[model samples]
Target chain A: MTQNRTLSLSGERFTAVYHIVCKPAEAEARARDICVEQTIEFPEALVTDASIRDQIVGQVLSLQAVGEARFEARIGYPVEAAGRELTQLINVLFGNISIKPGVRLVGFELPESLARQYRGPRFGQAGLRALVDVHDRPLLCTAIKPMGLSPVALADLAYRLALGGIHLIKDDHGLSDQTFCRYEERVRRCAEAVERANRETGQRCLYLPNVTAPAGEIASRARLAKDAGAGGLLFCPGLAGFDAMRALADDDALALPILSHPAFQGTFCVHPDAGLSHGVLFGQLNRLAGADATIFPSWGGRFSFTQAECRDLVAGATRPMGELRTIFPVPGGGMRLDRVAELSDFYGRDCILLIGGDLHAHGPDLIESCRRFVAQAG
Target chain B: MTQNRTLSLSGERFTAVYHIVCKPAEAEARARDICVEQTIEFPEALVTDASIRDQIVGQVLSLQAVGEARFEARIGYPVEAAGRELTQLINVLFGNISIKPGVRLVGFELPESLARQYRGPRFGQAGLRALVDVHDRPLLCTAIKPMGLSPVALADLAYRLALGGIHLIKDDHGLSDQTFCRYEERVRRCAEAVERANRETGQRCLYLPNVTAPAGEIASRARLAKDAGAGGLLFCPGLAGFDAMRALADDDALALPILSHPAFQGTFCVHPDAGLSHGVLFGQLNRLAGADATIFPSWGGRFSFTQAECRDLVAGATRPMGELRTIFPVPGGGMRLDRVAELSDFYGRDCILLIGGDLHAHGPDLIESCRRFVAQAG
Candidate 1:
């Protein structure tokens, strides 16, 4: 497990790199304060023991001034301190200090012992490609729209979209267990509809249901979706917690491709010099938590994510890290049919081009619109 | 149940208010787009049916131009649309729109039918006061510190804090199932030590262990804490989704008071006009998720929460909601013994004042320092 080597070498340390923007004079003190705030949040006097001070306390590795009032601080935390758990790792990385401004988590360097504990991406890009039987083209995915539609109506839309050649169809993140469209009913009808359409058209179309619910109901719902012939599961890790998504990915019974939808998560990445970077928050963290594919607002969309941030996100998903598999970055939110070729070229075949409302805009013929989207992408 | 009244009232609608900052000319268009983006996310033509439009589409209620390019918009959604679930409710409230900048969720008004589904705060201000038997005075809560401490050392600290008449001794949020101090061992020893100290001093001091873990282990850990004789559970709702905290709170077997800690959640409320308001995110939402006490960084701390926001949070906790009990507003993060009286006066009797590292600086004698803290607060 590499545990012996990690433990033997300077008390099992993992480096946490933070992008800090503060007065150059205060950068060193701020970096030290981060160490204390994240670890032994007590005064220096309380840390009576030498071992606690030397072994447990975070050590500042390097501080490089990037610009005026901006410095990048690299700090090392004892790997044993995080217990090799995602939740605790996040806590050790940015727990108490997240309350303070001007400290953004840019990257992390996990020791082999710590990184081995996580099971990242059960069905990554290749697995997902195999699931949908899409070989050499960017996959076309869309969301069943207009929340508050009855299960029957939504399933009807799913049937048409599947028949028209969209490879992956998922419930809009908004379509939860509402009264008008209950989760079980929606999953059952939509799955059957997609299956029926796939059989008729001789195409492989997957219906991914949103299984985000109360903590108790999440697993059961995932099980239900699997039993109902759903191809994959969609969840808002931001709302349901990243660990919840990891739990589903790690589960044997409901072992299906999981797609993470970004909802109520913008606050973390929206700020330039606070919170986390796009690559770390959306890409690396999502992949580490076992997302087969992650959905984000595309650049040139209504959101504020810049082109550079989008590129970084792509890099994060595809980058190599230990045994973690590379994941597909699905870009949506204001993605249109005409831009399918442009986005396909931009993201290449590894990406899933998600076009939502724009599919409906290409006339009342939803099937024709889907066909055009697939044809354009190919 | 008020289901009849809520259902009968013209489609059971609930209003979500947002504070938006944009160009003066774009205010009206932005408000309309929010309704579309949050609800349908489809082309206007696809919302062909009038009934679908009326029931599903978010209707803009009011838009007031507050300042130059700053406006407040109120939008209504069908209460049934949320399915009376916290996850869906949050999605319908924020969801895709959260990615858009300049739009901040200010407040929400849920219909009684929707509100009744949530069991907010199993033990509220009065219930907690009854639990600790400290009816007239503010509660004294201190976090057992220095993350690298073993279970035995932390238990000893808990014992000393309890002997000194501290009402609640909690593991610091950072002490989450780490190899240095495992969860079960720490809970067992600390709970026993606190119990022994209570017996010796004839007090009701309680030990609250941090039970935050992976998604699957949370409930079991809560059960373990209860079985170990711990008085309460501390979890970072932000790190381990809010629903996880709600699940622990809702569990009948482990009916201990649940404390919600703000670990990686500061970004949501730090911004003036980009994320959620302090009252809604920290107060109302935490209460809805059944946090007996919600801990946040207080004003005049290392964090940046304002005085007005703190007051708003208290009001959101204690204000009358349908059947939800009023929760305790725990003001923490750099709280001190000297300010106990001032904070007590500010928050009144129904508050928990958390003093962390400062308690140790008082003297080498931990018990005497705690005694002074308790005496000062009283």
Candidate 2:
């Protein structure tokens, strides 16, 4: 966060850095267009209120050419434009401008007055580590997958994984409330199974069910998961809006840990000259939205993210932002058992080591394989 | 939609057409990877359950070359996998696959059973036309913007626009609950102003307030707008999830027509080979999610959508899909008064002609400008 604090704000304005792809001659005008487009959204001459034009409209503080035919513009908007809500803040940041081509929101700087307003990560990396009682080493985690599995099969797998000393067992992101394995039934079965295994082995294991649902059902579903004795909840902010997760995380009654999944948000980081940077979306935005742990496609996996991008994402998650807590970076897209040592070295002890399919790939005895994973990662 | 029916379903399976950019030799393997990746999300060999593999796993039905090193693959999954929910359907459609590069969801075919389950557009093009009592011509629309304006100023603008016979007057997407003009005061004042003008002019002008808020507050705000005498609602499915709009549109109590705005969804259509097509996103998906009228960047607007893409989008909206009604395509975004005749000829009378700043730019008398716009468009 320190290194990426490229936005130098003067007064009560929050700055956003946009990567504008255009010719050198068009850079200043394009930057100005964004300044107006993001704020007033009216023609400059028509805005009769002088104070509104001066205070409310966005101002381009600085512009520099980053590459050939591409300039990075740092535009500042009044913090009042974002209001006090995360939704409005997001809209003010990248609402209408998202429709235009060649303008990518690379990074943003929210002043401490505004940044601290958001209650980010009720239970961050330390709180999660405390829950599992694994303080010094990377926490071992896995997802129960192959979506068509029934509640009984999934719960049985959950029991074995818990018994084998896995810290966290999450439902696969694809495992929504389908008829084959309904949400309530699956959460109850898996939570109870994990509890039973915890009692037997004296090792705490959490069963996190995916609670991504429609806007009307999402909050109620989170409450349902909590009532069903689930340890934590798996939320996809991309599917449900980011503020949905923030609301869940901020709720005192359902004060459970949230692990944000990047389900439909990949497009934000996939392109270089358009959309958002990987760090801004997966890291800063996730943490700002109250994710205790964030899962992204790690390097050397099925996804196309490079090691440098992964490192930047980790930094964005853990870096200091006023008083916000640092969350765990769970990088688990196509991660294997053999890569644990190397990943642990790369991410260090602060991350949650997530190995999904490879846990089942190691021989017929799933419990033994989990134990071996625990031993190897430990 | 008729011409782009590339998907051929069998039995109870709904098909999806994916544009996979890969080497010509690797197209088959890549198509197979999408099948396994989208559904099971595990190694194909490791999925031992024959029934699960047969019933739930995504299957590639056909693969063909579309362009230079680009292949179009139609993949099918059990209808039950969608789980009678829009959120689950979206998750199943693009969830984990969005993170993967070169895999774009171009089109999809939902069986009549699956399509009918979704409440597409309660008040579609016909219903909206009935509301305004203007069935013969394009409904002229304008947005009251310059985000920092007070509620009184905005209300005055709304009044003039309504009095001048603009069919729809909506709050600019930028005009959220900012401190200058909170949502409550703004919606109430604007709605009352529009109603007052409607009373004077003996017309059915509708005031549409932008109710795009945090997930929990969206429905409540929509209800508040209805209670305040607002004739319709403007929602951004991109900011709030698509299902949010569906939830609002489907709610019987709030039976206001919804206009879907493309706020943060530009990234999905910006890339040709990475995300969804303009038609699939703005048209078919919006209508499926219950938007009565979909607002997108017109071809000649400040945005970069071409005439071809705009035409495709219109087709996706209006084309017959089982028993679903057609939605109005409101082509806007920097649209001017001078282009009204050309746009009308382009989009036909079924579309809503939205001109924002140009009306204000015409003269000091906004009502006169609105009257001129109505006369010209009419």
Candidate 3:
């Protein structure tokens, strides 16, 4: 079982922090196993290449007891293992280890070389503000919904919402290219309606169509949205891969801001002790994958996310990460018009205030309701 | 908030079974909430259109007590809601509800029209058996491993494994286009090496290269593998979106048998009362999304999958689903040669027996170990 060659150890390494839930005696062993499992995926004893053992296998930089029967271990892996791609970086981060229980990836620190390789967030917080011509207050955003609505009805709603000064109006993540409202017709009518409203009101309201489609059609669908005058794009990185979102962001031809929606991604963060933390998935990862704004369930909503978790999520979105621009943390999910002031005070102007169904509560004249929402949000 | 129009509902519908964990008093409310949350996403009180309520919004078909504080709820949604795409089907199935706790998607039943829409496995069990010309026994598969290995070293291993009578030799999922072994070079050399071995041995051994690259590079890389004479393709539907795998499976140009690797997909199945059941994620979903063979961590392995869970996974893979062909249930992850008989009895001949690191144990003489694995497996 002897190898003929010794591969060079790539010097640059990235660190990942994991919270391992185990007994005091099992902590060290579990940490060591994670190091081996994430990297080589082979028996360490038989790895005859000493350099492979020393350099390639994950190095446990530090480990400490965080809570009863839980230990936080910081492990470093060579940047080469990531293959200098976001997809592979994620694979190296949590691939096979995700199947195992009690190993939650809390946070990570990538080397400068790897961080620079990804083109994150084309139109981040400042860029989004520039697009909407609003810098003083939180950007007011809404989703056009009730799945069975015809394209014309959806367009009418978009027109009114745009006239009322909503900065970013996006399609509901559930509104794919369904038969009731096909993607092309819906995007075209909404974009035109929003544009007509923008012309009348002198507001730079952006219509973000949900371009999340099948893999083959995603890029073409995005191009169609852009050609149809879509102001931005709403993508579900959880449903379509994170790399798909990154690819969308990095495409210079389709240079529209991207708003990431949390659809199938909830499994990664819902579990406290097994999957990722809320901040890591919705905040850091979303920004790194090139989302201009990332949407998640806000606290006090119908969803179960707590206030502390929401705060952590906000921090992760706005935190400094090399040269990557800070993305807007758009919090929605059962948000209300009455809570607009309280949310504004807590989230500050860097956030996008997303109120969906509640906008209808102030309706009859939906435009007037949106205007009231804007005034209250400010 | 009244709509101007009522859209028609296509009669064909799909039923999704969810395991809802809540207090006895809250079970009905939670089940109803899921139906609304998964479909229209708007507040039900505001959904004034009665036909929209009756047709488009998910309808709870039945609810039954499953366990303590756990109830099984079968909810049906119009097939039109799925948008005739695998990606949208998943979005409609788990999308927003993934964020909510206590909702586990355990099973689903799609209408014949919807099932017929997807191009499932191009090379199913029978097709795969024909390709290898082996029908009487369980197929033997091994992964070339140790992340730092060069293309030459990997090809050498492939040559030996092929000579020793293994049916399939796939690149370790970790062996993406790393600088140590770029995908093009690795695929070319390994394909040539395996072909040379087949010439001498007169046994059909498929060298499946790991074609899981970043979104932009995946199709090109898959084409390169096929052009270079690789026998099959290995993909991580979880890493690259499941629809990406489906796209590859459906593509007329680069049509190769795809082996689905469970890398980043573990989160969907790990939680006991949340996420998806092992059968749904690994078996049914994989087949629906066009995976010819689905690899999972077997019970008694380094991973935490139990024997019961593995059996459920096998059932999910081979169960009758409209016109969709049955796929191979590959159980790997630290599987050993000694357990071949037990696994063979349990999984039956329709499965692919994947033994990774253990193949090196009877080694020094690697080919001999593979031969012994084949003999024991048969």
Candidate 4:
């Protein structure tokens, strides 16, 4: 089997998702029975009312179908679990839950015949080199506004930051579809502002926006962001699904890189001897899922990840991929400007450096403000 | 705020969903950049990619994108942040990867309100009492088979168990959409055999089939199971998303009690500190989600939860719900007939005693098999 992105659709298991529509009143029973038949992957099953009414059998999680003809359903089963060695890739396409209604398996893909698939990180090490016209050394990144900033206010910040030589500028997680600024409008204006600054300063900076939603509607937004002239879009794959990140990686029309966030994902890393290690979770998994750069809370930050964990994350990001590209690890969160050289020493050059609220408290000439970070860190 | 299950929509915060389709090739890139944008929350405001990619925005975390097209997409923003938040809701639907040509947002439902919509275990306490004919005491349950049991073999076991007075009988999670035990055939025979046993013993034992799949096709399957004379269904809300499970509870037409299973959900409990607590995750959440009975890995067994966690889980299950029914917690995973007394003592008489493989390892007489558990447990 080729370990490249261009995987053979045959043999590898496939999954097809479908969303069914039904009266809200009947959603739970419907979802349960469908999933049992699909994923339990067994036979002669019997469930009793004692089980249902007492939640002995069906454990309902959301009440979305509270007053509508909607219910979310999912069935997952291994393709070749037993005698069902494999057949019409379509039929077995995640046959686990295919029959359940109101559960449309939107993210469909072919799994490797073996345990793994793509090597991931398409433009990893060398590719990124070609993109930013950089052969070596690290990268830099900063945020625009955390809250309550107009689009122009954000763009003005983008211009000064871009001119001052920051590599990328993005909105804070809290900057989502808020009344203060809209996604399409803000992204468009910021990209333009960055482009204008690039023309004068001759530095290339990318503009990215946050995009995270339910199960549908991610594609058009990417297109919209692209049309608006933004460099890329950002998302929380854990909240959405890692497959969503995989999807973004495969779309060229959107033609931008993806950055993974750790919001709501801390639970997975907070435990030791349990859950994926930080390197494996934020670094390798994100890379495998096609992250260009994976972010983690740095040492001496408000968050609790240790310096060792941060270092391991960087190593995992830059490590080898079989016939795939390498990923860059972005270590940020509660960083101090005075420690710019320390961060550089710890992460080296091929990293995206992030600075948040501290940027503002450093004296307001925005340009002069950022130039200081560059002088000390660079 | 009225709690109407029919046609009422109410929520404190406006929640919308987005769905995006990938162009197949640029999937990874689109995935990576999206992460950067959302997490960094619009970095173009102050950083230059070259400088950051090469030098200053100094922080942590990095990103990379893929060149695959057929990827997934979705974005979530506050209702106040989006225009006609409901209109753009489609963008974040189907998980953001179902909006393009090849994919589709199969199913979704955003609760009109977020103030605890689901009231789990519809008839959790009282409902199950009415069905079983045995009020106020614990419910005894025993699984039917291991992986290699034939249909006739399983049928015989079901018949004996039902006649022996086991209140609930369910298929192992390992059984599913497989050739070994086809769903329809197994369900038909089991229901019939249990019926035959009921006639002879005058004991009405309800059969619970594991019904798990994507939400879309669940209605029909549920209808099929209900019509098939099966008593109820089983489901896994973790893998399929908790919302899918709640959808099942609202299903009164086939009003089978829902039994929540813990398969891929160990993570939620395994991380003692970070993830949800055993009591909250299993008890409160499941109760709120509508699980009449939830199956969890019992302590002093194969799984890792401690004795306190297990006890807390039971407490969570049966705790008082102001207007809703209390759920039964089914502690399983490697329990045996020998522990029936201990389990009963620990959980009291209101729980569903679940023992799987141990039943198989017991002397093969199905009648004696279930008799041992019920007699000893009670």
RMSD of each: 3.9, 5.5, 1.1, 16.9
Model 2 lDDT per residue over B323-344, tens place: 7889999999999988889999
Across A261-340, the per-residue lDDT of candidate 3 in tens digits comes to 99998888888888888878998899889999989999889998998889889878988787889999998999999998
Best-performing candidate as measured by DockQ: 3
DockQ, candidate 4, comes to 0.05
Count clashing residue pairs in model 2: 0
lDDT of each: 0.86, 0.87, 0.90, 0.57
Instruction: Give model 3's TM-score versus the native structure.
Output: 0.99
- What interface RMSD, in Å and to 1 decimal, does model 4 have? 15.3
> What is the C-alpha DockQ of each candidate?
0.52, 0.45, 0.76, 0.05
Give one digit per residue, the lDDT tens place, for model 4 in B1-378: 011112111112322111223554554444443333332333344333332222111121222222243233332333333223321232222122211112222112233342234455776866876787777677877666543344565677788789888888887655544444566777787888888988898877888776654323445656777887877777665444344466667777878888887654454455332344577667765676678888887877645568988887877776554555788888776687888888888888788888765664555465677777777876
- Which ten-residue region of model 4 chain B has the weakest summed lDDT? B1-10
Point to the candidate with the largest TM-score: 3
Question: Which candidate achieves the best lDDT against the true structure?
Answer: 3
Query: For model 3, how does the per-residue alpha-carbon lDDT over B1-378 read when each residue is reduced to its tens digit?
Result: 546487777776899999999999999999999999999999888888787888888988999999999999999999999988888899889999999998999889988989989879998999999999998899999998888888888889889989999999999999988887788888999999999999999988999998888888889998998999988999998888999999889988988899999998898889888999988999999999889999999998899999999988988888888888899999999899999999999888889999999989875999899989988987
Q: Could you tell me which residue pairs clash in candidate 2?
A: none
TM-scores of all predicted structures: 0.96, 0.96, 0.99, 0.60
**Which 10 consecutive residues of model 4 chain A have the lowest summed lDDT?**
A1-10
Name model 3 segments beyond 4 Å from true: A1-4
User: By the DockQ metric, which is better: model 1 or model 2?
Assistant: 1
The digit string of per-residue lDDT tens for model 2 on A20-90 reads: 99999999999999999888888899776677778888999999999999999999999988887787788
